[model samples]
Target: MKKLQVLYIAAFFAVCLVPFVGMAVTGQESSSENRTLAEFPQLKTEEGINVQWLNDAGEYFQDHFAFRNELVTANALINGKILGTSTASGVIQGTDGWLYYKDSLEDYLGENLLKDRSLYNISHILSLMQEYLAEKNVQFAFTVAPNKNSLYDENMPYYDSYKVSDNKNLINLQKYLKNENVSYVDLYEPLAKADEILYHKRDSHWNNKGAACASDFLLEGLGKEHESYTDETYTVKTDFTGDLDEMLYPLATTPEDEIYYDRQTTFAYVGEVGSNFDPRITTVNPVKTGSLVMYRDSFGNALLPFMADAYGNAYFSRGIPYQLTDVDTMVADTVVVERAERFLPEMAESAPVMPAPERTVSTGEDKADPEAVKDLEIITQGNYLKISGRIAEKYLDTESRIYVRTDGDKVYEAFPNDVTLDDGSTDCGGFTLYLPVGTATEKGNLEILTGNDESADIIFAKD
Candidate 1:
C-alpha cells in the first residue's frame, strides 16, 4: 500500500514538471554559442505569409531547444569517442584526444581554391602599392602566416591520406609574390622546428610560442634581433578553452592553457584608433626608427607588440574591403601586409571595394531619398534583373539596404556586387546589382526598395 502511494506521488510530480521544462528550454540566448537566438519572423504588409516563415521558425526552435548544448556535447562524445568517426560539427577526432577542424584542412590543402589571375593581380597591386610607398622611403612586405594544419597535420588521424596539391591558391600566390619581387616572409620553417606544440590543440590560432616565433621573424626581417626583455613580461593561465572546441562541445568547455604577454615601450600618443569597420591603429613607442603600416588579419593581434617595439609608430588595418586611399594616407616608413593562407583570395579584389551605390543605399526609409540612387537602369539577363546606377558615396560604409518584392508574391534581397569609384573620395560613381533570379521573369514587374528609396513596380522585360 505504501509503495502504491509513492508511485502515485511520483507520477504527480512528473506531470507537474512538464511546464517548467518547457519554460527552461525556451531560453532567450545561449552564452556558449556566442550568438543571439533568432527571433520569430515579422509580418510584412508588402509580402504576405511565405514558405520561408515556417522554415525560419523551425530553425529558431531547434537552435533554442531545451538542453541544446548538452545534447550536442553528448552526441559529439558518442560519435567521437565510441564510434571513432568525425563529428557532425566538422571536428575530426585525432589521436590522444586531439581535435582538428576540417575547415582548417580545407585551407591548408588548398581546397575550393581561388583563381590564378586574381592571385597575380594581387601581386601587381602590391607592386604598385609598394612603389607608392617606396617613393616615400617606406618598404612594403607581405607576411604569409602558416595554417595550423600545415604545421601540425601529423596530429590528424588521416593525415597520411591527405594529398598535397600544387594547384593550391597559397602555392600559386607565393610563386607570384616571388616573381613580382614582393618582399615577404614565411613563418612555417622556424615554427615547425620548435619542439613544443606552438598551436592550441583545440583552436585554429597559434599559441604564445607560435606567435613569438612569428614576431621573431618580423624583427629579423626589419634587420633587428628580438632581445627586448627590458619591459616585456608574460603571465600564464590554465583551464582555457579554444573557440573551435567551444563550437563543437559548448557545454563541455574543453580546457587548455594560455599565456598573455605585455611589452613596455617608450613613446607618446599621436592619435586615437580608427573606426570599427576600418581599424586604423597608430601608437607611439620607444623605438624612434620610423613608422610602419601593416594590413593584417587576426594573426596581427599577436604580432603587433613586436612591430610596435621596432618602429616609431605602427598603423594596422584590415586587408579586405580595403581603401587604396587609406593605404596611401596612412603613411609609414615601412608597409607590411600580413595575410593568412585562408584569405589569399582577398588580394585579387579591387581597392576601396566600391560596391554599387555601395551596399548602403536607400534602405529602410519609408520615403525615397532623391540622392540615394542615381542614373538607375533596370535590365534583364538570363533569369536575373540587374540594377545599374550611381549611388551616393556616403552610404558605402555600411551594408547595402535594398529589397526586392514581387506584388503579392515573394521578397528577396538584391546584391550590389560590382563598383567603380571615379574620384575615390566620398562619392560612389558606379555600381551593379543582381536581383534574386527565380522571382524575376520577362513577363513580370518587380518592386525595388533601396533603403528608403521605394520604387513602383517596374517591368524587367526588354523594351
Candidate 2:
C-alpha cells in the first residue's frame, strides 16, 4: 500500500511539471520575439529603438505597486492602498537608486519613447495656426515641454538613457520649424543647461520648484515680467509615488519621499473641454477659488495654473484631438499646445492630409473653363476668425459625401453636401466653406468626417 501511494504522488508531481515546461518555452519565445528590432528606413538612429524586455519587466513590476488616496470613488482601489499605508505614507525601493513618491504612466513613456508623433502633429497644427493667425494679423508663439527623463537623464541608469540628439523626427521637426521662421521656446536645452531640478526624484512630474523656473523662463520669452512665488509658499505633499516608479521597480524596497506644489494660487485660462463623444468645459482653481480654462496634457497640469494667474484665462485638455474642435468655443485668446518631444511624429501623421487642392469649376454652358474656387476665407467683427482648407476629390462609381461637424451638432453647416468633380476640367470634385460677414459667431468646434472610421478635427474660433 505504501508503494502504491508513493507512485500516485509521483505521477501527480510529473503532471504538474508538464504545464511548467510548456510555460517556460512560451515565455522564452516571446522574449526572443521582443528583442527583434522593427525595420524603419527613415529612422537615423536605431541604437536603443527596441527594448523588447521592457514589457516583461513592466508586467513583473506591476504586481508589487501600491495605490493610494481615495480622492474620488472612481479611484477607490487606489484609495484603499493609500489607507493601508502607515500614516497614509508608503515607500518602495526602485531599480533607479533614488527614492520617489509613486509611479505615473506619463513618466514611463515620456522616458521610454524618444520620438513621438504627437509633437510633430502639434507642430503641423501650430503651422496651421500660424497660417490662420497670420491671415488674421495675429502673432503666434509655441513651446514644447521636456520630460523628467530629459531633465534627469544622467541620474538614470546608464542603460536607460535616451539619445535625444539623434532622434530623427525631433531633429527634423526642430530644423523645419526654425527654417520656417516659427517662433518657439526651447525648454529642453535650457533645463539641461540650467541644471534645474524640474522633476521630483520619486515622482514622474516636476515639483512646483521646477515649474516656477519654467514659468519664469516662459514669462521672459513672452516678454512678460516674472512674479514672486518662493519655496516657502509651496507645500510638500507627502507619501505619493508616480506612474514610472509603479512600472519600473515596485517590489524593491525604499524610503519615503514627498512632492511639492504651489498650494495657494489662482490662474485664468481659456480652452475647449470634454470629449467629442461627450462635450463640456471643466474648470479648476488649485490655489484660490476661481475658474480657468486649460489646454493641457500631463505636462500642462503642473505649469498651467501658475501661468494662469498671469493671464486672465487658461485653457487645458488631455490631447484627445476629437475634442479639440471645441477650442474656439472655449473663448480662448491664447492657445498653448503642450506636448513632450516623443509625441510629435504621431501627431503629424494623424493630421488630415491637405485635402486635394480645389479643382477649377467649369460652367460647361460657357465654352470657357471657370476659375477654381479659392481657399475658404472669413472675416469676423471681433478680431477672432478661423480659416480652414482641405483637398477634396470624388470618384464616379462611389458616391462620396464630405461632412463637417461642429461641437456636437452634426453637419452643423457645410458648403456643398454631395458634389462630384470626376471630370478632368474640374478634377471631378471640390468645395470651399466660408462663414459670410455678419454670420453669428460663437465658441464652437469643427471636424471633417466621412463614414465611421475616417475623421479629423479642425479647431476654430469666431468673434
Query: Pick by lDDT: which candidate is best?
Result: 1
How displaced is residue 246 in candidate 2, in Å? 2.0
Residues 317-373, candidate 2: write the lDDT tens digits.
554442323344555444455556545533443332122112222111211111222
Give model 2's clash tally: 58
lDDT, candidate 1, residue 83? 73
- What's model 2's TM-score? 0.48
Query: Residue 266, candidate 1: how far off, in angstroms?
Result: 5.5
- In model 1, where do residues sit more than 4 Å from their true spots? 1-26, 31-39, 86-90, 107-115, 164-168, 224-236, 260-282, 286-289, 327-330, 350-463
